[model samples]
Target: MNITLVLFLIVVGITLVITGWAARRTRTTVQFWAAGRGIKGWQNGLAIAGDYMSAASFLGIAGLIAFNGYDGFMYSVGWLVAYLTVLFLIAEPMRNTGKYTLADVLSYRMSPIPVRSAAAFSTVAVSASYMMAQMIGAGSLIKILIPSLDTTLKPWFNWTILGTKLDPSITLVGVLMMIYVIAGGMVATTWVQIVKAVMLMGGAILLSFLVLLHFGFNLGGFFNAIAGVKDSKTGLNFTQPGILYTYGKTQVWGVDKALLENVSLGMALILGTAGLPHILMRFFTVPDAKAARQSVAWAMGLIGSFYIMTTFLGFGAATLVGKSNICATVAPKCTPNSNLAAPRLAEYLGNSFFGTGGGEFLLAFIAAVAFATILAVVAGLTLAASGAFSHDFYVNVIRTHLLHGHVSEREQVLVARITAALVGLLSIWLAARVGATANAAALVAGVAFVIASAANLPAILFTLFWKRFNTWGAVASLVGGSLVTIWLVAIGPGWSAPRPGWAPNRSLRRDPVSTRGERPAPLPYIFLVSQRDLVGLIALDVACLLAAAMMLRAWRRRRTRPPLVAAIFVVVLAAVATVLVLLGVTYSLVVGPTFIVALLVIMYTARYERRVTQR
Candidate 1:
C-alpha cells in the first residue's frame, strides 16, 4: 500500500519482464555465458563501470570521506589510478587470448583437469567474497530506508519470521536480480548495468549540483564552511587532520609519519585491479584486442569522473550535514563507520524529502536507486562465478559425457542457473555469519584484493609475456598466494578478538603479559618470544616474493626462450613491488625487517634465473 513499496515492485516487475524476454533466445552455451560475444565495446565498457562501482563506492567511499577525510580520498585515488595501469597492460592481451573467463586465458595451455579446477575455485572464492559485501550493503540500506519493516515476510507480504528485520526493499532487489540473471545471463545483466550506470551518474550529478547550489555556486564558500567548523570541546578543526585521521583514533597517513599502510593499500589497488575476475572477464565480451583496449580507456574516463563527483558529495556532507546529523542518520552508535556517510548527507540535503513528513516519494525513489545498485552488483558477481563453474569447471572438466553425446543448450543454461543460485545462497550464509562480527565490508573487500593480487595477478602477468611460463608454475603461484593471504589475515593483527563471555578466558588475551611486581612488563612474550608481528611480516613477505620467484623460474625454463616483453614485465613487477615495500618501511619498523627479507629473496630469484638461462 505504501508509495515506497509500490515504486520498488514496479521496478522489479519491469526488470523481470525484460530478463524473461532476453532469455527466450538463448540457444547455446556461448550465448548463455558470454552473450554470444557480440557485445559492443562501449556497451561492455559501461557494464564494466557498473560492475566496478558497487555500494562500496557510492556508500562506503562517501562514508569514508564524511568520516576519515583524506584517507577516504586515498581509497578513491588508489582505485581509480589502478585502472590506468590496466589500460596500459592487461586489457587487450586478456581479451585476445580468452574465450569467456580469466580461467580460459590462464589455463589455455594446461590440461583441463587441474588448471580449470584451480581457476574455478579461485573465481568462486573471489566472486563470493565480493558478492557477500554487496549483499550486506543491500541489507544495511534496507534497514535504514524501511525502518518500520518487520524481520521477515513470506509469499507476497505476510508476517514477520526469524532472522534480523531486513528491509523489504533488499528482499525485493534480491529476488528481482536473481530472476533477471537466471533468465537472461549476460544479456540481461549487461543492459541492466548500462541502465543503472546512466541513472547513477545522473543521480550523482543532480546531488552535486544541489549541494553546490546551496552554497550559491561558490566552491570557495563550500570549503570555507568546512574549514570554519571546529568542535569547541574537542578543539580540533573538522578539516585539519583530513577526514580519516579525525574520524579514527589512529592517524590516517600512518604512525611515525610513514605512508606504509597507504602504500600497501595502493599496491593492492593497482596490481589487484588487473586480476579481478569480473572486470577481466568483461574484456572477453567485446570483439577484439582493440575493443578491449578502448573499453578500458572509456572505463577510466567514466570511473574517474564519477569519483571526482563523489569527492564533492563527501565534502558537502561534512560541511552542510554536520557530524551529529550523520551519526544519527547513518549509525546511531558513536562508533565511526564511513559506510553511512553519503546516505546521511543525501538525507540531510533532501531533508524536505525525508524525516517527519514531506518528501516521502523522493526518499523512496532514492532508496529504490540504492537498492538497484546492490542488485546490479550482486547479479554481476553471481554471473561471473556461475559462468566459471558451468563453463570452466563442469563443461571443461566433465567433458567426456557431454562431448560424446549431444548436449542441449537449455541444459547448459539450467546448469548455470543452478550454479548461480548455489553461489548466491552460500554467499548469503557467509555474509550473515560474518555480519555478526565487526567491519564485515572492509574485511571482505580486503580479502577480495588480496586474492586478486596474490593468486591471479602473478599468473596473469606471466602468461602474457613470459615465454618459459609453464602451467605448473602458474598453478603454484595461484595456490600459494591465495593460501598465504588467507593465513596472514587469520593470524594478523587485524583479526578481531572473540567477544567477552564467548571465549573460555572471558577476556581478550593480548599475548601473555609478563609482570614486574604486579605491574605489567614492557613486553609480553608468546611461546617464549615476541613472534606475532615478526611471523606476520615474514609470512606476507615470503608469500609475495616466493610467488614472483616461482613465475620467474618458470619463465626461464621454457624451450622457446624468453621474449623482450616477458623480460620487461618481470623487471617492472620487481621494481614496483620493491619500491612499494621500501616506501611502506619508511614509516614503521614493522615492515622494514620484512622488506629486507623480501629484497634478499628477490636477489636470490634473479641469481637463480641467470643460472637457469646459462644452463
Candidate 2:
C-alpha cells in the first residue's frame, strides 16, 4: 500500500471511530450543538487553536512564506493579533448573552425577526466562503500527495457523475465532512479538532526543529538565510514587502497601493475573528463566560506559538527546498502555486535524515495531518452555517412567523442535521468550480475575512457597545455590508480575468487577428466572487454606509414628499445599477458603495417619516 494512503486511512479510521462514539451522546439539542457545555477550558482552547490554525495557517501560510518571503509572514502577524479582539470584546459577552449562535445575542436588544434573519444570512455567507478555501486547499494537497492517482489510476477515480466530472479529492473531502457533522455533531467535531491540532502542532514543531538543526541551531544563520533568499523566476529578494501586494505601479490617495492593501488586509485579519461564526460558536461549547475567557487565553498561547513557528517552516522551505523544486512546469515534483511547499520540505528533510523511504513516510505523515486539519475545519464551518440557518432563521424567524409557537428540540436537531448535509453538498460543488491554481491563504483572507469584517463585525461591535444601536442599524449593516462586499468581489480581478485557454500564444502576440485562439474576459459579475480586492473595498463600503446613515438622519425632521421621492429614485437606480453591474454595463467600484448608501437612505426615510406623520 502507498504510505500516503495508509497514513490517510489511519487518520480517517480514528476520526470515524470518534464520530460513532459522539453520535450516541448527540441526542439532545444541547449535546448536538454545544456538547452539553461540558468542555473544559483547556480542551476548548485546544479546539479553538485547531479551528483557527486550519489549512490556511499550515499549508497556505507556509506556501505564502516560501513564495513571497517576508510579505507572506504578514498573514501570521495579522491572525495572531486578531485574538485580542476575541478575548477582550467577544468571547465572554457572547457566551453570556447568546445560546446557540451569534444571532442569539444580536436579537437580545432588538427585534428578533429582522435581526436574526440578517444575522443568519451573514453567518452562512461567511462560513461558506471560508469553507471554500479549506476545500480548495484539501483538493490541491490530495492531488500532490497521491500523485499516482493522476497517472496510474486516473480513470478509476476521476469519472463523470450526472454530466459533471467529479474531482475525486473534493468529493471525498465533502463526503467525509458531511458524515462527521450529520452523524457526530459538535461532540465529534470538537474531538476531531483537538486531535488535528495536536498533530498539526507536532508536525510544525518538528519541521521547525529540523530546519533549525540544518543551521546548527544558529538563529543568526536562519535570519541571514531569509534575508538573502531570492526567487528563481522573478529574481526578487525574499526580505521585501512589495512582491505580492505591489504588483502594479498604481497609487491610491498619495500612498503606495501596497501600503493601502496591507492596511486593509491587516484590518480584516484583526477584526474578522471576533465575528467568525465558527470561532464564536466555540465559546458556547464552554460552560460559562469564565470558561470562555479561559479558552481564549489557552487558544492565544497555542495559536501564538504555532504562528511564530511558521517562520521556520516558510523560510526553511524557501532556502532549503528551493522555489524551483517546490513549483515547476515539469514532472517528478510538479506542485502548483507552492501549495505543497510544507510537505515537499518535509520530504526533503526526511530524505536527508532518514533516506528516501523515510522521506516518503514523513511526507505522508505531514500530508495526513494537513488533511486532518482541513477535515476538522470544514466540519466546524458546516456546523456553524447549518446552526445559523436551522436555529436562527428556520426556527426563530420562519417557524415563529408560521407556526407561531415553539419548535420541539428533536425537530430542531433534525433540521440542523439535514441542513448540514445540504450545506456540505453545495459547498463541495462550489469549491470544485474554483480553479486548482488558487492560493488557499489568499482565498481565505480575501473572501472570508472581507465578508466577516464587512457584514458581521460592525453589527457585533454596535450590538455590544453602542447605546443607540437598534434593529434597523443591525439589519442595514448585515444586509448592506454583505451585498456590497460580494459585489466588489464579483467584479474584482480573479473572476473578471479572461477564462481558461484564452491566453495569446507568444508567437501570435504581434498580430491581433492571429491571436484568434485567445478569448475575451468574462462578463463582470457573471461568475462567482473571488479572493482578491478586499483591503480598500471593505473600508470604502463601511465608510459609505455609516456616512449615509448619519447624513440621512439629519433630514429626519424634514421628511416630506421630496425626500421620500428621492429615496425611491435612489433605490430604483440602485436596482438598475446592480443589474447593469452584473451584465458588465457598469463597474462595481462605481456602484458597489451605493448599495449601502441606498439601503440606509431608505431606512432613514421609513423611520423618521413615520414618526413625523405620527406627530
Q: Best-fitting candidate, measured by TM-score?
A: 2
Model 1, 267-384: lDDT tens per residue? 9899888788888878877878888877777778888988988877777877777655665244546644455566656666676434443346555666666666777788888888
Q: Give the TM-score of candidate 2.
A: 0.85
Q: What local lDDT score does residue 327 receive in model 1, on the 0 to 100 scale? A: 55
The 0-to-1 C-alpha lDDT of every candidate, in the order given, reads: 0.68, 0.81
How do the residues 1-615 of candidate 2 rate in per-residue lDDT, one tens digit apiece?
Answer: 688888888999999999999999998899998999999999999999988898877877888899889888998999989999999899998999889899998999998988999999999989988888888767776787766534544565576645566667877888999999999999999999999999999999999999999999999988888878876545678887667776556565556677888898899899888889999999999999899999999999999999888878988999998777886344676646577789889999999988899899998999899889999999999999999999999988989865798899899999999999999988877777664546433654577888888889899889999989999899998988788888887655445345332223334224222332253454534453332333333444455445444545545656456464544556455555555444533354655666566666666666666666789
Off by over 4 Å in 1: 148-173, 230-258, 328-337, 352-359, 400-410, 436-438, 494-496, 499-615
List candidate 2 segments past 4 Å from native: 148-163, 231-236, 246-249, 328-336, 439-441, 499-591, 603-615
**Residue 108 of candidate 2: its Cα lDDT?**
92
Best model number under lDDT: 2
* Model 2: lDDT to the true structure: 0.81
Q: Return the lDDT, model 1, position 62.
A: 76
